[model samples]
Target chain A: MEVLAHGLGGRTDLPLDAVAAIVGGGAAVAASFLALTVAWRRPRLRPEGGRPVPARIARALDSPALTWAGRTVALAAAVFVVVVALAGPGGEKANLAPWALYVTFWVGLVPASVLLGPVWRRVNPLRTLHDGLCRITRADPAGRWPIPKRLGYWPAAAWLTGFVWLELVAPHRSDPRLVGVLIIAYGAVNLALARVCGRDWFTRGDGFEAYSNLLARMCPVGRRGDGTLVLRTPLTGLMRVTGEPGLVAAACVLIGSTGFDGITRTTYWRDNVDPGSLSAGTLGLAAAIGVVTVLYLAGMRVSAALTGEAAGELPGRFAATLLPIALGYTVAHYFSFFVLEGQMTFILASDPFGTGLNLLGSTGHRIDYDLAGPTLTAQVQVNAIVLGHIAATIAAHDLALRTQPAHRTVRGQLPIAVVMVALTCAGLFALLSG
Target chain B: MRGVRLRTVVMAVAIGVAVTLAGCGEPAAPSGGTGGSGGTSGTGTAKSAPATFTGPSRKPDVTVVSATVSRGKVEIAQNGVNAQGRVKVRRGATVRITVTTDEADEFHLHGYDRTLKLSPGRPGTLDVVADKTGVFEAELHHSGARVFELQVS
Candidate 1:
């Protein structure tokens, strides 16, 4: 009955009655599917159509001065984190590097991107540095050779998988020096790739950039290809996601990583899985990803066969539907971790070097656990998971209508809808059973 | 208007489901309240309740239980027989755990927040009184490998 330490939020006694949460989640998704099938006939989300933002507001947001300022701030913060990580005390208590990477940057990026629309792309320090180096050398930043079109987002997917493995499976992930070294290594590799691939490399190659850009598609406020700031429905923005190469793999990685995170904390995993073997943990992580991929691909195949569409085209066609589900799992798994340990970033910012100098006067601040008690945490987790499933169902239904003939739409989506329900149940079980 | 109505219906359904789920679980109660007191009563009376000790001792004089934790297994001796399970101690009992691991790790006892650094082949010992009656996780800090649960009751 030992409450295992899963993530940043210590000992989460989520007061969710497992049966009720799972049942409610499954029912909610099923109800949403029925509602969509009955009421929704045409594809409502139009990616190309949006109301233009006011001239004054759009001008300010797109200003060169604002972009430079954001880049400067991001670069300065990156430098500060590196300094502290290298020079500061190594433990989680004294070091801010781990908290910054895991809780703040990794988890915080989700809400930030969803609200602000690809904030990381605008403020990415590595991109700025690469551009600066290109300027100094009087050379093209996009490198002499072009990145092949077929490469697509595969590199981003691979790198994302590697990053998650480091976070969830690596033995010394919490060590500040190790985190710092990884950050430096990641930046070096990406910057070198950026020089050859040009600035477009970040759009599809950088893992964090790809992650931010994908989430940003759901943001209501987004700039069109012509740099016109427009306000659209969130679903409209989500419709803009293209099914590029490895998009399915990327989505599965997101879903499966979160799945592993939840399952690893359960009594079932603890009692059954070998704790001391790295191979066991790796297998568990891979199996979770494999299960999600297989289930999603199977659903898409059934839908494709019914609709008379190519099976190869179905993955990317239905990839956008997974975003909400991924976002849901991210929110459910990291909500408390972000709220509680996110504060540590600010506290550690005050004393980055673990020296007594209180730079930000936040060194003495304590995290308020009452902000998310067990009851409130459980409610949010359940609601977020269920709502996410509902959103996914709607997104999939809309896509199915747009892709398939009107006569085949409902029948084609039936299997996928069932898959969504099952995934919702699995998600709820992970959150509650843990 | 149709979109708005559909959104409203979805919202209503979500709220209804949330309410139903919330109603299924009991409200959160203070940790170690009646449960801890009851467990103390069930166990034999304390021979001597130390005046200064109201909580788990930072340092305690106790029998050191030797355990070996590898990548996936926790090996401990029980009654001269090797067994794999959580460490159990009575409430108010002073307890010490000496652990050896195949890899370097920061050994952490969660509820107590006591930490020990264990290196490969090198054993580390942690001592604390079982002042609280509850199940607490003991794990490797970075790797997140659970060594065992310390069930004190």
Candidate 2:
């Protein structure tokens, strides 16, 4: 009922076998790049060729009634969780707040966005709350000051770093009372900021919004420039990500924090370098993010040297390629917990306040850990990491050719390919050895 | 014409990786103490991969392990000097863990939800069957200090 101390979900994933899996993952990444060099001679994915979805389906999706309904339901869910978390039973088992936030909402966003394309933007409760406040007060949605030109996505990146730290390193993070206070404080701050910065601020400032939108770049379903719902190659969606300010920072934070999370669970870190205090944990998380940021910049610098491109802009230019890898790391790390804890949340939601009443009647069902056995899970994890690397390599290679002449494309991508292999191997080794 | 060839290359890469994934070991079920040898296997899973799932073995071989809590630190039995935060046991084996604490606390094995109340001098025992394969943390509830994770595979 209390689950584990550091976070939710009592049973953590089994460590991967050390030798074979890491070697396989690294070699697979290397082989994919090498194979791509010989055959994938030029950029192929059509970024402008999204076949428009049928008009009727697009109209249904665009319907204002559906949009309002979605926003209303999402707001209601948020309020319900907040109320129960604040006033409900203290036990995590009886309280649905922490589970809903961590498993059902946060981890669930990955797959949901991958499949449905940034559903959070459509259903964000904060946006609705802000709109309601504005309409009631008859205040202009657009504020007096323009959001600074240099600000770009830096706010989003900072919010993301803050959120990951809370999820991964914050002490007593799983407690419902703490969760309630934090979410309320977080919502209030964001709402206040939105009121000052205007409606468009949420697009580049809210952490969850940016997180979902980043991942949605990998979704096959997307809207064209004209707002028509269109179906495109998933890679094309990824290829279209522009190198906006803080784009690299956001990507690095995502990949690095995930990498840090994998490292924390390893036996080597726990036994050898166990940081005793919260300050130590905060430092470790920062160090992990810093390591990833430096490695990525170094890779881009080398890419510039080889391609004869300007060194200053290469990191931003290639930042879009990291999205697939980030998604892969996310899936590899959180999917199993999502499946197991998601069911637990469903059952707990049936009794939001630990009252005897089972609202959804799901409390009668049991949480089945057998949904994924160890062997099956390990294979999936390994495959997810390896597949992510291959996709990244493909994206990088395509972008290289598209950005410049084909003559130096393969050579320019070689350094990045090496970097990808190193990241993939380090990730696998850390996960397995732990 | 080029698109078809490029797709072929991607397919080849995917198939090659799938083969590698298949070669990766299952970590458990193989070379584990499934033969009822009663601790003879002793973590020697370095041998050939049988790739076979052995049937249900003899009675749950209960391993008696203990931990002592003092000076606000937990010292697990036989896992000192280089503790990996857990004791490894093959799935299907039963473990009977005993703990003595300087503080009044309750021993909780999560996932299994097995709990035992502990007094300052009096020890408590939690008997668990490692039927599920994963790492479950065991902790002292009141102090919230971990008493070694149970790594069942």
Candidate 3:
């Protein structure tokens, strides 16, 4: 019982349920932090523009397998496919929180361009679309496109908006027929925009360019080779930009999570209620877009920080220092849901579908399969998730610091990470135990 | 560096405060108002407190709207009623209920203190008994008005 109360195991009140939540919860935290850190700050020591370059653009474009346009369209198409598949009729519900699916996307996109060393120019979606559409319609897709210095990038913004709409607005409509119409209407909007801007505008935006450029700054200062990078911005500006965005992203995450939860509630339960059919899911979708935009803005801020100058404006500096704030947001947002839905375990265990999703599963006969029952190992799985992310962040931060002198290590940062992780674990354990 | 450390300390303290505040919303003491306690109503004995029921009844009009071995689950269409001639209750008979509302309304049995208010088209159920035995009203309410009713004995 003491272990149940203070340990990662959720609660002694409900023995079976606590087990799953503890392990899984712990692991999720650890994995997310670690993955983000490792992926962001790992040093491959690649040489920057030091290699003798063939002076031809043609030489750069001469990869046999994929033209730049081909790759951009392919990536976009892949994203589209995954989104549709996951949110589609029979697809799993979109619960990509501290979990793998969400982490995977972050991991893939973050390190992809940097690890591969600035392929953004080639895979620029705008350029790809311009080329692809031209070939498809046999029309000239290329013109001297003006790069607007003030214009915020649109690819992530648009994608984020579309996702919000799906989650909030479209999901709530009770009439399947109306939902189909709205989807078609949304597709039309995308098509029209693609037609007007020529696919390149959407694909080859300044966002990824900005990202890659920022990453380049973090490379070795004067190490002129295949493995060096340079930092260049004012520390104050970098700090201001990086700090706000991360916090904003954390806020967005909370909003997004809540919005999705609301949408799910309304669509599956509330809308189906006898009198509330007048509501539409569009409002929720709009809210989701807002949340996602905040996330994007935050992401851009991180990119901006990487580009910012000063040796102290390094990855480890942020990782070791600012990680607690980030982790704090994570705990607040996720725990909100945990508090709301955690009791579902008890409800479902006693009588599956005592409320909500259970009604749909009723088969006259009481089936033995109960999803609400949390086994002992399930606790481990949950905790493992939390633990994994923290560990990953620490490892990543440590690795980034390796690029600098050991004496210069901001030792204070390590304690911050440990304290945050420990506090979170302890609190979570209390919740489970209680 | 010390100043930065101080800021970190302040932030940590802030987080701790927020978490403590959040913890206040944890589940309250379990009230033990669980569903499914059943007993038969004594005929004509109107109790002051809310009525509850268990066991079977071979009566008409008073129906158990659920699917269970105790009470054969019968379908009641929108704005329609089931044939109310006979009802048989089981021991420890929880009147397993399955109600699907096509609109927002409250399903309240006038004789029972319990009432279930559901959203439009949402389905929900609760277990209570016809504890008191007398003429009673099963009322469906909407926006604070009684929309429909069923007679119970």
Candidate 4:
């Protein structure tokens, strides 16, 4: 049904899943292209008007929408709690899966929080309250980061670890209510911790801002202050703070400990029902998350290093070597999902729950992909997900490198990318058919 | 600035209109039961299934087509036409039951056992006999409220 919906032949019904995969996959590649291009061109391609721009600290103080969204989510959690209470333990009538909610929230954050600034600043209650507190106390909340810079990577690590524990270890992967409870609890805890970390967590040093700035060097730095965008390069060195990174380390420690505590306490209950029977599968998922995170971090590191080099040169001289590895990982992980979870293969297509396959848009303009058939899965493996990501990253770097040398356009590399995409699709077709 | 506001307002209006339209269209409710409770087992036969299991009724969208208890076998046929349906058994040891649905729905016998997804136009069955007996509800799930009742000894 999923394959038919995302039919091989292009009809009016249009395979939403396939189109989504292409567009989404394509966009990620495009971002990589922008990054690479910036690197290749070096310092010269830096936007004409915006260079050596003095850091504007005022805008940084303004809250991001993400923070507001988090608060709003926390508010709505009231509804979930009410439902759970009324529904009771034996009340399995309603289908509410919290795991799905967690996936959606984090997935949304990845591109925004990681690739861009938190964007939640405008709506962030914590920031607003922190600023107010600072004003009332007449203290410098911006001087020292509450947390340490070294502890910056812990959130992502914690996120990865949490997924491992919930999906793999604590069992009840199939239980919607349990999953929902976990998400609510996690959110509540994060919010509470953020309150303790205070405003200094962001303003103290380069922290997330630094990582974002490094990410910016990879792509054509978009016009800043042209109105907020879902995507923006992080401000550089926002993460680097001098004094005690204690508060930050404490936050990480708290998160990690809680995750472990949740596992230990829940393990007994899980063992009784024991859904995630295959310990190997659990390990594989953990490994996959680690691999993806490392690959992503590595890609960023390479982009950063290349940016440091002289202008008008190829960015990341060695980035191309990692493309195949990243691509291979994408294929392996996605295929693993298909092999392990028989039901989730066509998840993008069918909303057995009435969600529908047209996630991004209406029927004619959907952007999802059909993972129903081997052919489609192969297409995703080679062309869209894996190879596509590599192409984009490489393309971005190349563009950055070639941005200099007025005569030499990165346009030449476009052909290579096209060829690679075609080759990937062809390879996928062959593999899937075979 | 005008363009941004306009876009936001337009998007909001569009969403509102879509939502309103969605609300207007009524979901296929359990009109009533068509078949008898048990023509095969010589029990009572039902003609007109409830036309609509209206507001907060005990049998809201509920239907129990058949129920039987023989020497060591208990059989029950149910249509997930309503939100909640009930089944009463006389005496059976190892019970085997079958459930069929007219459209795509779920058949979950609450308290007795787990639920299974029933494909459209296809029937799904769950079979379990009593070892420990306390009255339990054989409930069918609708959207909001689930209609069910006590399975008396």
Candidate 5:
């Protein structure tokens, strides 16, 4: 009668040698900033510069049939999960729906987007459903009303927060019926919004879509103005990101959620924070997000003042630089879960309804817990967090060079660089301590 | 050019230092439990009292056994009265855990892969030799409630 816990469970990492890892990470960031200030004079990450993919390949990727196929596969998977969630046994071991959503989809999106670009946009079932309905009705895919410009990505940010709360804090997160209901509610709400707002709803309104798109900015494979596939530097793609409203909130939600995930696993959190009460968990999640947002805002304000830019506009302007940091935390926190539980997804898929049907021939699969030992896991976590901060520091420095005068560039970036170091240290500490 | 070269050298030195520091901070290897601490030190330490068997049978050393459940909440005795954070024991120690619940449920100890069926008012016992050194989860299978973390140093 042994069963896996609701969340990914294993030996948590031993507490990091905090003094060494944090100080080292901080020093590296500071040194990089100083070197960049002196040695790097020009802005190198220009968005318009990229080598286009060969014409044949680009055309094949752009084909409407390919897009439809992707949408179909995504829709079919969603429908399967929904069916199983409704009828499958309530236990986590007996259900494939939770594994598919949490491990395969949520954690899998990081590497998938990084390698293949924004796959979710092409494969989002709700968007496909909306488009199909529109075609059937003889209406334009773009809805009657345009989404308000001021609304921007705020709804997506709110939705992202709500999703994290459900995944990390909700008592019934592993309950199949609850998950199924939430999925249906999420899809229905987004589909209705898309009806009024058109295709733009998926880009700036859907939480998962926005999350995928943001991470995709770090992907080297992108499209040009003519929809031709191109190979570009990740930095170039990141630089092209526009300062959209609510971008800061969205980024903070990502950073904060991952931070809280790490903290919730620690002995301190487990012992002090009552497991039965949702209040402590909710407050902790909010506090983590708040701290990240406040620190980011402070850095932006300082940089803005130094560069003679508008303080009010700094948050959105600097938001894209934090994407790498978010990506780093994500990779560090979810790497093991993705590796271990991701295998379980295949096993569960074989008998999704718990009727013992071995459809995929994966029923014999066994999860190898020793695939990643504690030492290796700790090393990877530290490296990811540190490397991500380094990437963010470089991006911020380059952005400062682009925005400020030659004399002011270094001054403007100093505060932001320090903030990046602090954030890196914080991320490292959380991983190690947790 | 001089400033560029100087900055390059400095950056290289800083990176070297960072890498060196990281390498120096490799975590200590998991060791046999011996230290006495009332609470978990976030690492290996036997924090529980030596077990006392009431029966005529003299068995191996039992660190801590028996946990009570009421209204879906689990309570284990640390010093001997109330349940708390974790039950820490030395490696190779024989640990027998008995769980009594208000409802019939499956009790599972993760990592060790031990399971028991607990009937209402009847205590179910799971005996295991703590040969492995790590923290394993003790949980109620049906309710998915974690009873406590078992740390075997």
Candidate 6:
């Protein structure tokens, strides 16, 4: 049981009981079937109209002054973090860099994007740095060559995989020096690439940006097709997720790795597998992610055969629906950790340099574990999984209305339905089983 | 709407399944009620305010497991040999983790962050109340040797 505490391996929520997991998976499947049967035949979620905010309000929110100020603040924070990471105290306890990256930025990005809609893009320090350098050199911020259309989100998927590997498989992942080096390296590579690839590089290239943008698609607040800022149901935002190339890979990477993380938490995994073995970790991660991809592709193939749609197109066609499932897995796996250790992010932020000087007087409290009870945590986990399944089903059903012929819609969705159910069960079982 | 009717049907079937399955095992709801003084333990109540820890009146039900570390090798034995696995128990059970190390090491229980300092040729005991639920690792913090995991549900 030599399970090295994964970075921020603080507190894990208690596993769900068999009954809850079963009931959840059962209810999820049942509701999804019912939804598919009763859902509207026509494509209901149009990309056009939502409750549009006033133009003046939208302008104020997206104003240059606000953007510049936010970017400047973000740049300053980035500079401060780099300084602390390079020069501050070394240990996990004293150093603030690891917590800032893993806890605040990595884990915190989920809720932030879900709530605030692509908040990172607005405040990405790397983007700001590129813009500043470009301005200083009197160069165009958008670089010379436009990013190729065929390369949709593939780089994002690759970089996201790299990051997931770093988080879950890489040795010394918790080391402050490693974190600093990673940050610097990631920045330098992306900044240099951004210089040549134009501003669209970050949209489809920067892994963090892609992840933020992916999650933000489910946010209620977003711009419509005409660039009108509108408030709508979160599911409607999900409807807007295009089945572009590599979208499936990105979603699979997110959810599959989360499932792998869940597996690592299990006593069975810890006992049988070498906990600290990098090869084992990498193999398990790849296998988990591969299982998801294989299942999805297989489901799509079945659905395509039944519906007479191209198999290649179906994976992309239905990729948007996976977002909810991805969100579900994320919420189930990391919700407790974020709620509990997320406190450390803010606390450490106050004394960023490992110095006694507290910029914000917020380091007075410790992580309140009892804030999230085991029962509530279990409920959230199961409910999130169930709800995510339901949402994905509905989205698939609706998208099916658009993609598949009217006669073939139900038949085509049957396979995807099974896929959703299987994925949901796999997720629930991962939560419950040791 | 057909959806409305299906929803009702689904709920009824779910209830039926739940009732049928309840006979097989304990209800999957939170059932641990061994709260010492935290009186809000009817169903894992939201513990916000710091309650005074009044140690229980009844004798603590203790589950003891011991480990021996010698020359970078760990041998965990509960009662016999080669039985090192997750020590699982219901919430509120007391677990006394005993460890004897050939070298100086500190056993750190994660999640609870409880620590027990151990020296050579001396066995150290750390008593932990399984108040919180989760899988927590007991590791030699310095050596990063994870001895065992405690699973409290």
Write down the C-alpha DockQ for each prediction. Answer: 0.07, 0.18, 0.03, 0.03, 0.09, 0.15
Choose the strongest candidate by DockQ.
2
Say which candidate scores most in TM-score: 2
Candidate 1 per-residue C-alpha lDDT over A198-301 given as tens digits, one digit per residue, 9 for 90 to 100: 98898889999999998887777886667789987666666643477888888899999898878876667768876545687789889999999999999989
TM-score against truth, every candidate: 0.80, 0.88, 0.36, 0.39, 0.82, 0.87
Q: Any runs in candidate 3 off by more than 4 Å, and if so which?
A: A1-133, A142-155, A169-171, A195-388, A395-434, B1-95, B98-153
Report the lDDT tens digits of candidate 5 across residue range A1-434.
Answer: 22222244433434567788888888877888888888888988777778998889888987899998999999999998888888887866668788788877887777777667899998999888898889888877788899889888899899999988877777767777777888899999998888887988899899999989988887778876666688877756677434889888999999998998788766777777765457987898999999999999999899889889888876887798889889888877776566555666677787787777878676534444444455655666776787778778878788777777788888888889879988988887876663
lDDT of 3 at B96: 34
lDDT of 4 by residue, A100-187 (tens): 2322222222223322334443333335545656678776655343665656544533554555355334534435566556655654
Clashing pairs in 6: none
The lDDT of each candidate is 0.73, 0.75, 0.35, 0.34, 0.73, 0.74
User: How would the candidate models be sorted by TM-score, starting from the highest?
Assistant: 2, 6, 5, 1, 4, 3
On DockQ, the stronger of 1 and 4 is 1
Instruction: List the RMSD of every prediction in angstroms.
Output: 7.8, 7.6, 17.4, 16.0, 8.8, 8.2
- Chain B, candidate 6: TM? 0.60
Quote the positional error of residue A229 for candidate 5 in Å.
Answer: 2.2
Give the winner by lDDT: 2 or 5: 2
Whole-model lDDT, model 2: 0.75
Candidate 6: give the TM-score of chain A. 0.95
lDDT of 3 by residue, A1-434 (tens): 00000001111112124445546555555555545444544433232333333436334544645664557664564344334333433211112111111212222233333223345545644455456666888865533444343333334334444443433333333222333344345444544455665444444233334344333222112223333233211111112122222223322333343334323322133223322222433444345536444433443344334434353343323432232232332333233223222222222222231223433232122111121123322333233234423433443344435443433333423433443454345434433331
Task: Please provide, for model 3 over B51-120, each residue's C-alpha lDDT reduced to its tens digit, 9 standing for 90 to 100.
Answer: 3442343223233453111121223422134423122232233343445555566665442334676665
* Ten contiguous residues with the weakest lDDT in model 3 chain A: A1-10
Per-residue lDDT value at A294 in model 2: 94
Worst 10 residues of 5 chain A by lDDT: A1-10
